[model samples]
Target chain A: MRAANERVRVAFQGERGAFSEEAAIKLLGEEIELVPRPTFEALFTSIDEGASDYILAPIENSLAGSVHRTYDLLLERTLHIIAETIIPIAHHLIGCPQASFDDVRVVESHPVALAQCERFFAAHPHIKRVVAEDTAGSVRRVIERGDPAYAAIAGERAARVYGGRILREHLEDHHENYTRFVLLSSEPRVVADGDKLSLVVRLKHRPGALYYALEPFARRAINLLKIESRPVAGQPWQYRFYLDLQAKMGDPELDAALAQLRERADEVRFLGCYRSAQRTEKERF
Target chain B: MRAANERVRVAFQGERGAFSEEAAIKLLGEEIELVPRPTFEALFTSIDEGASDYILAPIENSLAGSVHRTYDLLLERTLHIIAETIIPIAHHLIGCPQASFDDVRVVESHPVALAQCERFFAAHPHIKRVVAEDTAGSVRRVIERGDPAYAAIAGERAARVYGGRILREHLEDHHENYTRFVLLSSEPRVVADGDKLSLVVRLKHRPGALYYALEPFARRAINLLKIESRPVAGQPWQYRFYLDLQAKMGDPELDAALAQLRERADEVRFLGCYRSAQRTEKERF
Candidate 1:
């Protein structure tokens, strides 16, 4: 309905200042439109509803591991991953503009966010934790309520967007927290210089089935970036493995390896082939 | 310290009638003493605190995927997984004895349990959803309040323990929902018939390092039950892998494979060698 030169509408879960929104802005320029959805279900179906051009979804976190619901949704939908981006997660305690760190007596955020800042809570034994649906939304509510005793844990961007103040910074227990996000599009994206390939393969139930499937890539010295085994729904014990491999697009050896792999694997679906985000420099501290 | 014949105390996360309690009873039998801890951290440290002789924790769920926190805690401690058990997860809508299905206006449970009953919630849009810290705790509170408008979602055991009535049965969206838990002990468990081995390995950051590491096992036709790559702390883009392999304890080929694998891997820690849970029959519906 719109020209290709028009701004792309990127859909993400949570409020405007959520991590997914920041990732979309980093990958696509600031000119893109941010479409915020209340839930992952709505975010995944935004393209079909003509509300978005692309969906940026968090696939995994360094500490939290894989986002299972997102992976299951990817399998349910026809969307394809075209690119990916990784961002550092730094949780900050935000409050009203007039609020100070010493005034905070209650904190609220998503359960996972609250759990990550256990050490901070341990230090402040009197502070109570309450759960909220969205991290950024909590910041907005805390500021709107204008209670100096209440604060929320979220990113620094959330404080700026919602006119809140940063009462304290970096409340997470681990400094290595980072989340990986994938950009999904309805139409297939074929990058000529793509070097990373993600595939989901289901093998027949037999001894060494996975080992045999990897032989083709292993013999060729293809680097295996990651391998995750997810249980196949309705079938106990059996699993489907998701592999991330390092190989340039259109490489003859990669083609040969895939052909050889097809014989051993019962089903192999190419989730994507795109440039990896590993080449991107880390965020400056 | 008590003798071996004394009742073994098992530490698990959550209150009584929790899934972990059921798992402990199934693996160690009814003679064991149940020690409930409020959090995973306390449960993992129970042995050092002299509160329990063994720890039982959920490692994976069929629909939800692996519990990353449990894996991380395993790496932090020196505990060894001695055995595993799988249990079916069937959520039931529970209410006070005087409450009926038609009188319920709200439901409360763990977020995971609430998420699993999407179909039931969608059918009853008027019923508000609330999040609770524990599944059985929610049932206990709802029944104690004796509110006909409030209900909790939990297992059948929770209803029996809390004296709550089951308003609805099998509220989970999928019939295949199940959870796998492992029995952990401070001392190594030697099983003469052990057929499964788990190892945490760190390999050099090279293209063929992982491929070569798997060569020894693959050549011996050893089955890889699972493979999970976790990001190494403080090292971005680097990973430490946890592998589950199928092989009898002290098998000549398994020994040869490990000996060869050591040369390729930078570091290898044997988590445990125990019998596989797949040999156990599935729970009858």
Candidate 2:
């Protein structure tokens, strides 16, 4: 799908108006072609099959911890992280052309979206809350049904794409809600000045193992952006820790710390060292 | 609601025929009466407000990593665990009168229930999957709609409660899928012979921090049943680890290990030491 190496084709999971798509365009700009996949595996397969040059997926959300499937997929696939971006989420309540507050009976959207808009729904308890596969998919359903009683809670972009009217905007309870997306490619890219390193480490199932695992970062005074753990399969009570540190793998100090971490850890994998995107101004509620 | 100290009133988050209600019954038996709450917070609030003696909540599933909100709520509330039980999930495809496989166009259930029945829906792609607040709630929606084309995937108990017929049984993709429920009470209960201890530990950001965290169990050869992590609010990159160990807190070795773990960890909190339910053979798929 790429005409040249400069124009990378990125694959993401979800429909056209998905926040993931918004993240992809924000990070890569509007020049690159975006391909949508139904599932996370399909996104990785697209990269592995050479159908796309890169894949952009949400790693974590400020409100909803880590996207476990994305982490598991990252561990399963051999793709390299090339960049990262944080997208501010501004959820909106949308409805069909003939729908109004009085006509609406059911509101549909993803569980996460519905949860973020808890305050809005709490104010109007009469409307039935329904969870759909995707936010845009819900919009599509409302359009297809042509039922005035059906509405969805999604992004403003989704409302425009599906030709739905915005019944209410900025419905999320929190203003700091944001989702972090990681860009992965088949080949690695050079880490620029403002790059971040991501690593996954499997430690020995012993006392003080994780303490020793984090010693390197602590000793180096490195700023850790995030740290999470997932169950290590086949091992009854062990876990593999994933961390994001504010230093590139190429940095001498970071390289040294990683080397020390590797010596103490049972297994260590360098997920990637990628340039981090600058945080955009917070969207006002 | 308590007539005597021996009897306790437990609040569960679900309707009358929910699996959660069944879990509450199994945990407390006929001696304790169940107070059903529509939401998880209500269950916790019932305990906090001194309206209930204890609360039984589903913490995790074998297939799902963790019921995250439960973890967050556990951290937010000061409730202590007094007992725990494991429940095997058995999902059933149910529909109202006049609705058959051919006529069904939409299937509704709780998000978790819908996820468990992914394989069934994949085989019948024409049927749209919808997510309701709960399994029994989905059945209630079908009954309220009185639409033959609208079906629901719920538990057999829910089907009977809502006067629906089973279109298909044992719809979960994984035959061995089970959910782990924790019993929370106002005060800690005495640990008996067959008891398990649960703890929440926060480790300092350093290398081998987690390894050191679990050293107590590893040194004494005490079995750890489960370990999961949740982020600490206001502290980016820091986490609080939740662990379930096989031995009770009263055990000399367990006590020593916890002491050492507390010394090494940034913070340590003992949720409770409670009797673990007997493991029953899973029902036939």
Candidate 3:
């Protein structure tokens, strides 16, 4: 920890009132300074540019699955994951403060947000859906336009920040939608309570290569939380598997498993060791 | 074999000259009647709706990975996969026949097509990018507009059918970009040359559920082509894994492994048994 007056600066992609900002605040608290970058490229380079002390990036969503750009950027940068947080994705129809739900004729948002509220769009077929660059930025634009016929789909925080009104709440088709975000820093830090480990492993392109690599962990009965295969950037059809396992930092068993993995696989990279976020039990579909 | 006069009607999603249409013709021959649907839902329902005899759907892309919507629809619909095809994705700058490359100031296509030609767009920053519903449809519209300043990015087939000129060739960032499509019919057909098997399995939430599921195949040195985990509907964090393996329909070893897999997994679903596409070997990065 730094001195009392020194606040950590966290960089995120999108406008000021984006979901990344909410996740960063949830993980790092309100005292941290928010460094909002316009694009993903700018967000990843914020630390190297000395504009931020930490970077908060959205890694995956329950509905959309993994964010491939974040995975690619993680490999490109030398940042280490320090912690993670999950936030429920609640899409609302927001408009200028003077606007009402009845006045809305056109809805605007990121294409994804517009796609997610298919049921609402279907019910109101007359309402035109316009694609915008950013979710929060759509809210900003809607408020700035001050047109009652125009509204945007975004988070509640965006409406508050942009001085917009929530014309309708919970417009998302799925109630269980959630986004998982990871906090990263240039320098690695030790977390005594860390109980999760993430790894990116590349195996030789041969039969049973992945099977042999997972043997060490299987033998130890290590719980695998998630696994994803992503294509290697320069190699077509070849992939690197990303695995999340329940193992704390400094665990001797995990260390032994890593040692065995390194010997069996072509390459193994530790992405992070951090505490797992508490999973919320929601109504099953 | 089709009758002398009775042509097989193949349904695909998009305009007349979409990549799906080209793939359909490449796989089923040019003598077949083409049925074009505006949306994926309509494409999948074309057989049941009595508009077409067969449906062609894109299952995976080497660059974009699996198309999740197609996978979900495959599971939802009772259609059977009878055959498969692969097509190279080559985006071209298409315009009115009289328009030259330098005359274009605006480019339009499906957002994904636009994204794949990032290098070309970056080099020509003066041109504005517009998102359209379909790549082939964009070419149709651009040709209809007959504006020298407007162009669209699409496969060569789109330009051919739409009477558009190819102003620039191979705008795609990667030469290895390809999409794999599966042929679907209401009734299953026996494939004697089938050498590939696809499965969707659900395992109990346990420490080594997946490890045990893969044991039967791993022990036999069977090659696994692809595996993807998708969120189980209604179950927030639970997942169902889809696997593609290299195996024939009636191979004894594969039969034995699948038997063991069924016994070990909570649920196992066989999506299809068909011949694998010819693999292309490129220089290793």
Candidate 2 lDDT over B1-285, as tens digits, reads: 444565667888877678887788766686777687888767788977877877889987766567887887887888788878877778987888667767789988887788677688789889887767788778878877888898888777778877987877899977766677888877766766646778899888765566666767776878766667776654433568888777855579987988899899988888888776643323221
DockQ in order: 0.56, 0.24, 0.48
Question: Compared to the true structure, candidate 3 yields what TM-score?
Answer: 0.91
Q: Which pairs in model 3 have colliding backbones?
A: A285-B234
Two-chain DockQ for model 2:
0.24
Off by over 4 Å in 3: A1-6, A98-105, A279-285, B1-6, B103-105, B145-149, B279-285
Residue range A121-164, candidate 1, lDDT tens digits:
98998999887777998998898899999999999889989999
Query: What are the per-residue Cα lDDT tens digits for candidate 2 across A1-285?
Result: 334566768899888788988999988899988888877768878977777878999987777678887987898888788788888788987888778767888999888888778788788889888777788878878888988898988887788888988877899987767778999887777776646788898887765566667778777777666667776543322568788887855679988988899899989988888766543323322
RMSD to native for every prediction?
2.1, 4.5, 3.3
The stretch of ten residues in a row with the least summed lDDT in candidate 2 chain A is: A276-285
Top-down DockQ ranking: 1, 3, 2
TM-score of each: 0.95, 0.81, 0.91
Ordered from best to worst lDDT, the candidate numbers read 1, 3, 2
- Evaluated at residue B140, the lDDT of candidate 1 is 93
* Best by the DockQ measure: 1
lDDT of 1 by residue, B1-285 (tens): 688788989999988888888888888899999999978888999999999999999998887778877888999999898998888899999999999899999999988899889899989999998887779888999999999999999999899999999999999999989898988999998976888899999998877777778879888889878877777776766788888998887889999999998988999999898877767635344
- On the 0 to 100 scale, the lDDT of residue B52 in model 3 is 93
